[model samples]
Target: MKDLACQQFQDTVAEFLIRHQSILDIISKSQESNARVNRAVVKAVTHCGCVKVRAEKSAIPPEATLADLKQLLDSHLDGELCPNCREIIESEMGKSIFYLTALCHSLGLSLADVLQREHEKVSTLRVFNFT
Candidate 1:
């Protein structure tokens, strides 16, 4: 159960960050009494970028495959993120997931509930597509 929570938290953070690419440079901290988790997430996302860095959202174009999305990025970024950023993002993401998993253990809050709330916030933002 704990392991699943960790994975879910990681996935949720990735999705939210991917959907909100403009804030990639910002380090979002928790406003709750405990901020360690949020700080971890901010660090992780910074290091790895998103699994799927959708530059902008449109309904998935009819012919697009996940590979295409990744391939596009590979061709574009040259070789994913630089080494330093990758390390930072991975470490931060791992820390954040661990904290969130701990929250699930202590507070009985489902990862989905927290992730959903975060996604709701992203859904409301205005995203501009340039292509």
Candidate 2:
């Protein structure tokens, strides 16, 4: 959906994806294509899905522009206008990155070492349901 909406920048995104494909492919391969995640996590990942279905006045892939992505990524919470939400989200992201790094280290793998094994599959929790 995000990709389709970014069609105007199709070429740019395609090139970026190509440069980043190795990491993307590995992370994708690490997770089972069909598996149930924690119910709460599922809810978060599917938030856009819900919004899409319900016709809410929230952001969709198409509504999102390059500037919005940049704002979300910039380190300054001041840019967000809502500092508390921005801080909370960034904090959660930090914890998630730490969790991924530690888990990867314990498994003798780099963060990019995420690859699915046909014989066994494990859960990867990207977010904690703190909110």
Candidate 3:
């Protein structure tokens, strides 16, 4: 019903990105610190119902195994990999932005347009804003 303003839209998207970046920073730090990596991965798998009630379940695929993923993260950290964890973090964060951008593009909506609409919606809400 209303045309989205560019400044408001960009600010809203920037805020969203900043919040996601903060969460990612915590995860990345945990990975680098080697704290709870195995436990977190295991918990995620179990929560997804991937594990069996019996003693053993199906083996994790080589590529998808937590071990492999951690190795990848570690290699990325060591500078042996072209992009350190920082690059990986950026790429992962970029993914959501890229996906939203693609969807907007396909729907004939500019990011500036949708973002401004979302901003207005957030601002209009009295109790809470970030969403």
Candidate 4:
């Protein structure tokens, strides 16, 4: 079911991406869309004041293990996205995904397959994946 949705999205992107047919265009647009996503999140925190970031260095004890790091670390986010901010962020994220799918289509890659492989890798590796 999830794979179907991903394939559908990829197909839709390939169909609609008439203007940005060039690989350069797809890559640049993908970057722009990603920047928009980051901008939307910043707006939610700064302009909307719906959320606040209280980020600081993690104080990991010398004896802490990899599993314990999960409990020790913090996202540092306070509150939540307001409805308006949430909508904007979702829209921006959709654009990001569209461009990402378009990039995959241009490269003759399957987004669903890529996602599945990554999922399997992360699932198998668990916390050690990052390290």
TM-scores for all predictions: 0.33, 0.28, 0.33, 0.97
Error of 4 at 67 (Å): 0.1
Better of 2 and 4 by lDDT: 4
Worst 10 residues of 4 by lDDT: 94-103
List, residue by residue over 6-125, the lDDT tens digit for candidate 3. Answer: 444434554555433454453454344343444433443454333323343444566674435443432111112223433544555455454454445434567876777877787797
Mark the 10 consecutive residues where model 3 has the least summed lDDT.
74-83
lDDT of 1 at 115: 69
- Kindly report which residue stretches of model 1 are placed more than 4 angstroms away from their true locations once superposed: 1-81, 125-131
Model 2 weakest 10-residue run by lDDT: 122-131
Candidate 2 local lDDT, 1-131, one digit each (tens) = 44343332333333444333454553553342222232323333344222112233434376776546544443321211244443544555544444344435434554433433311233332122111
After superposition, the stretches of candidate 3 with alpha carbons farther than 4 Å from their true spots are: 1-86, 128-131
How many pairs of residues in model 1 come into backbone collision? 3
lDDT of the candidates, in the order given = 0.49, 0.38, 0.46, 0.94
Top candidate (lDDT) = 4
Cα-based RMSD of candidate 2 = 18.2
Candidate 1 residue-wise lDDT, 1-131, digit = tens? 65476566656655555322333222232223136444444443555554323344444566886655644443222235556656655766665554444444345566666766767666765232212
The TM-score of predicted model 1 comes to 0.33
Best by TM-score: 4
The segments of candidate 2 whose C-alpha lies over 4 angstroms from its true place after superposition are 1-81, 112-131
